[model samples]
Target: MRTEAIEAWTQLYAAVGLLAVICASCAALKTIVELRGGTVAFPHATWTQKFLWFPRLWLRFQLAYMSGFPCIMGIALLYAHYIGFAAFNPS
Candidate 1:
């Protein structure tokens, strides 16, 4: 039972760590592209225009991403705890 809980926790952390790495990579790529004066493509031209015109649009994106990361992490943590508990105390 203890081993099963440990395994579940390990898997959960591994998945969350992978997600964090992917998010960081995306942010870094965006910064690199912006620094090179390349436009980030949007599905719509209007959205692209807004991003180009606003200047702070990228900053907003980063801010939103940063805020969202914690919320997602929290949810993942809760879910992992629930699953781990369930495994140890199956009804």
Candidate 2:
């Protein structure tokens, strides 16, 4: 019935939320590491440099994150709707 649809929708949305969180966290972590610069024995990365590097890396990360948000949201919303429809329509 309608209840089943709601349950399915909830599960779908929850999964999407989890995925978004993981993706954002990973990107953020990578950006952080890239911003931290120091070296003696290690190879020098162009991204890992003076104060300016942090802002640049951060800006890129933000842009990338923002770019992905819409797609992620759309996917999540679609999945939720599909699940909701499927759960309620046994036939």
What are the candidates' C-alpha RMSDs? 8.8, 7.3
For candidate 2, write residues 1-91 as lDDT tens digits: 4667667756876878887887788677766665574321233365455646556666768875777787788887777666655574533
Summarize candidate 1's per-residue lDDT along 1-91 as a digit string, tens digits: 5777667767777878777777777776666666567564433367767656546656745864585597568768787777756764423
Global fold similarity of model 1 (TM-score): 0.51
TM-score of 2: 0.51
Alpha-carbon runs more than 4 Å astray in model 1: 38-85, 88-91
For model 1 the local lDDT of residue 5 reads: 66
Off by over 4 Å in 2: 38-58, 66-85, 88-91
- Report lDDT per candidate: 0.66, 0.67
Residue 89 lDDT in candidate 2: 59
TM per model?
0.51, 0.51
lDDT for model 1: 0.66
